[model samples]
Target: QKEVEQDPGPLSVPEGAIVSLNCTYSNSAFQYFMWYRQYSRKGPELLMYTYSSGNKEDGRFTAQVDKSSKYISLFIRDSQPSDSATYLCALELSGGGADGLTFGKGTHLIIQP
Candidate 1:
């Protein structure tokens, strides 16, 4: 199994739908969970960062991590076309520092106008 994996979802939804994106990791040593938003050819911007298990909410986005299950998730409420972007889930290496990131394939999300 891959260290980290996510479905590359082209999940299309109406303007006001709630969206959910997810990822799973095989390494329990992973401590940092992050979500990134990428628009087309542009590089991804960090969306969520959390250590261990918990839920963090920012604006219309909510991020959840379950260390026990080695899973992570992002939820978007009241979605908009402007929110359309690819979501990537990642895990920071256990020891950290310059080891680079392990990223999922990313999910393409489209919010209809």
Candidate 2:
């Protein structure tokens, strides 16, 4: 199985609704988790990052990690049309050589007016 697994959701919601996305991993050695937002044909922009087991919040975005369950989540509040994009979950293993982060197949999200 892949180290990280996320539903490639074509998730749709009305503007102003709260959106929740999730990912799960099998590697216990993964200590760093990140959520990235990507616009079509554009590079991903980091939205949130967390280390180990804890919660991190920024503006309308929040990230959570649970080492015990090897699960992670991202919550987006007050969804807007501008927030329509692909969301990707990434993991960095503690001693992961130069291989860099392993990313999930991105979930596509759309906020409608």
Candidate 3:
């Protein structure tokens, strides 16, 4: 099984809608969880990350991590057409090593006007 599993969705939503993205992992060693946003033909950018099991919000985005359940989620509030992109969830071991990072399949989000 993949280290991280995400529904690579062309999840379409209207402008100003709420969007949700999710991922699950089987690795018990993973302690750091991250959400990445990727535009076509470009590298993914780190959207947010959390080490604790809780929700962290930044503006219109919220990242939630549940270590016990080995699950992570990203929420977009008042989503916009410009928000259309591929969203990826990533994980890393507690050691903080770069090589331990693993990514999900990515979910493609389309925000329609």
Candidate 4:
């Protein structure tokens, strides 16, 4: 299996709706979990990062990690058309160095009007 897998969803969601994006990993040594948002051809911007299993919230975004199940999720509470973009999940192994982040293909999300 791939180290990380995410649904490349062109998930069409109405504005103001909640959005959920998820990823699954096969490596247990991954200790850093991160979610990123990217628009068009721009590089992804880090939305949230969690060191281990637990939940981290920031504004309209919440990131949840479950090491036991090798799964991670990002929840967007207030969806908007401006929020339309691709969501990517990243992981860095325990012994990873400064540039060890591994990324998934990314899920395409669109918040319609």
lDDT of 3 by residue, 6-73 (tens): 99888999999999999999988888888999999999999998888999999999999888898899
On TM-score, the stronger of 1 and 2 is 1
RMSD of 4: 1.3
Number of the top-ranking candidate, with lDDT as the measure: 4
Clashes per candidate, residues 3 or more apart or on different chains: 0, 0, 0, 0
Give residue 24's lDDT in candidate 2 (0 to 100).
92
lDDT of 4 by residue, 1-113 (tens): 78899999899999999999999999888889999999998999999989979999999999999999999999999898999999999999864466679999899999999
Which regions of candidate 3 deviate over 4 angstroms?
none
Candidate 2 lDDT tens digits, 55-81: 899999989888999999999999999
Pairs clashing within candidate 2: none
Per-model lDDT: 0.91, 0.91, 0.91, 0.93
**TM-score of every model versus the real structure:** 0.94, 0.94, 0.95, 0.95
**Ranking 1 against 4 by TM-score, winner:** 4
lDDT of 1 by residue, 1-113 (tens): 88988999789999999999999999888888899999988999998888879999999999999999989999999999999999999888764575688999999999999
Q: Is candidate 3 or candidate 4 better by lDDT?
A: 4
